[model samples]
Target chain A: MAAQTKPVLHGYFRSSCSWRVRIAFALKGIEFEQVPVNLIKDGGQQLTEQYKALNPMQQVPAVEIDGITLSQSLAVIQYIDETRPGPRLLPGDPKARAQVRMISDLIASGVQPLQNLYVLQKIGAEKLQWAQHFIDRGFQALEPILKQTSGKYCVGDEISMADICLVPQVYNAERFKVDLRQYPTIKRLNKTLLEIEAFKVSHPSQQPDTPADLRA
Target chain B: MAAQTKPVLHGYFRSSCSWRVRIAFALKGIEFEQVPVNLIKDGGQQLTEQYKALNPMQQVPAVEIDGITLSQSLAVIQYIDETRPGPRLLPGDPKARAQVRMISDLIASGVQPLQNLYVLQKIGAEKLQWAQHFIDRGFQALEPILKQTSGKYCVGDEISMADICLVPQVYNAERFKVDLRQYPTIKRLNKTLLEIEAFKVSHPSQQPDTPADLRA
Candidate 1:
């Protein structure tokens, strides 16, 4: 067996993207240390020059592994799935893999960023309304696709990257007051997912940096 | 040799996501039939009941190939790269592949959706400013990473998916009036990318459906 290395993840408590990396680590059973970079404090610590140097994107959930730091939640997860001994986060067949990626990208690109903190801040007074609109648009598409793609998980009973992307985006949706009642498939899947050790332990409320009052 | 299937690409002339697929198809030497989905006509053709059934996301650049219709530009590109005999779009090494994905997702998730047509419309009076801000923010991160990751392309000398993503986004940045001079690496890479046949041919102005006045 290769030497075990504990990766260091630079992230915050409430960031959906950072929350994604946490779940992947838990699901894979890769023990790692978490360093909180409070996004809200000091006008967003992620926007600071030091954090920006660490991650040019200045985004939470940058992972330090094998002496290299990688940003982008999906990329960080992919690296962990690839280099570590973990449950495969992607599948074998070409088409199945594409389906997994399609679902993941739908949430990662199609939904999440549009309703993210930065974009929400720009929306000002109508932030909630804007978040709901984009979330609804995304979930409407995702529900039907998830119906076709999901079976106990986001992709056919196997916990894949799509599921990793799904849980946090669903958390964000609920935060913005988008009714998951409209997205039955997503709701069902999120319920099953939240029960899993990885998803449960990695929930924003359960994170190390989560405020005591916010802890559930 | 397998039977020649002229894959039909469902896209609009101006959709950056669609433009990404067009470049990938051209790069892979895939002969695809272009089906123009007029996003601006009839209150957006992509939102039609018929189109939504085809792609629940109602997004442009869904491709029909081998009797399967796939949506999401990155997913479609991955499908094409995987099943077809062509120059590879992602690298062989997992770390390298992760890097490519990081850059691609940066544009796909981090930048594009925030500045998408739907988001801009919702921004009302601040559309251009909003677009410029996100584009500039994304490009700032992208430029430095591209410097680390590029030789002739966004991820080494190979014209990977990152390059495919980069060109359309640079086009968007220019469209939004964001100064490319501020992102020297991106500007340089975009210049070189436009000179390539695949990217040049797939450009918005060169598309079959582009308005005569808009045509180059």
Candidate 2:
């Protein structure tokens, strides 16, 4: 609760939403402690009453900062951006900011949720097909929009929340065997973002809870 | 494109995402033109190349405002809130703003997308059961958070984007037969929000494209 207290992140190593918050913190040069809530452990640790108390949604990447806990990766990212002094995660211009939000929401709300671990578990035997179908659909729409919006990043040369959202999604796409060649703009943008130090440090493969075999 | 030009909204009458935009515009008292893109007509009008050009995502509720076309309801609502002079759609306080964003994302990304027509169509014969399951899961999480955050609205006394996201999802919950008694806080907030003119005018049944039998 004190101003000098380090923030705590309750997250899973490979959860895209959790990765988003990690990238935001790294980009802002803010140090935070990690409390990994392994999503797949013991029939999902996030479903336990203890973790649910921190985030009633029982989702990973619930952050305790500035004396309060916040969930939803986009919310956590924006909060860190607003309260921290760093390179802006959202652009200064209103239109560009809107573009960044549009891209972020398109992936966060429209695409990723369809293929998430929880949803796939419910999806049963056809999980791979379901994940591939939705990822492909999302990337198909994303490609043209990125072509219009990208300069050096997802919106006119700035590393933004959109760029933060892009990499994890592309990682998911590759995991599901979605061909990147079909979405050249998204592919190029994800590649460009991955080389950034903040993204590299915050990557799923680099996380504290990343299984030893999966660590970078 | 000009400041004086009326914005054009391309949307479906029943889409909760589109309804969220309608509520925000009405709350801000912005006058705009509506172009109905019937989702079920002609095997889905939103699938047309013409509509896809406006929104690469092929979703309803794409808005042409200030010369740029934006898809994604939350992005469009935030754009209007930032640019227009009206009651704030987002609270000014940092923590409160994050709470609003959290609730909005919970419903928008977590609950609604899973039950959307596209997803439900894929769900086949078990569509009702699938919708009920997710709505119950979302409302279960939301009820407790709303209990913690609500004063007279989802975050406080003022109507925020969280309120905009809540009503439509509640409507969907009712349509899917989720019991409202289980979520006293959400039910109370939705009841209070519905009495306001902005929400009433923006209800799905009152839309310009609402079919004769369906109109309120």
Best by DockQ: 2
Q: Could you tell me how far off, in angstroms, the CA of residue A86 lies in candidate 2 after the best superposition?
A: 0.6
For residues A167-213, write the lDDT of model 1, one tens digit per residue.
99998988888988988999999999999999999999988999999
Question: Which structure among the candidates has the greatest lDDT?
Answer: 2
Cα lDDT tens digits for candidate 1, B1-216: 767779999999999999999999999998999989998888899888988888998888788887777899999998889888889999988888989999999999999988888778777898999899999999999989888889988888888999999999999988988988878889888999999999989999999999999999
For every candidate, the chain B TM-score is 0.97, 0.98
TM-score of chain A of 1: 0.97
Which 10 residues in a row give candidate 2 chain A its minimum summed lDDT?
A1-10
User: What interface RMSD, in Å and to 1 decimal, does model 1 have?
Assistant: 1.1
Query: Residue A30 error for model 2, in Å?
Result: 0.2
- Displacement of residue A150 (Cα, Å) in model 1 is 1.5
lDDT of each: 0.89, 0.94
What would the TM-scores of all predictions be? 0.97, 0.98
Off by over 4 Å in 1: A2-4
**Tens digits of per-residue lDDT for model 2, B1-216:** 445888899998899999999999999999999999999989999999999999988988899999899999999999999999989999999999999999999998999999999999999999999999999999999998999999999998999999999999999998998888988899999999999999999999998999999988
Please give the lDDT score at residue B144 for candidate 1: 90
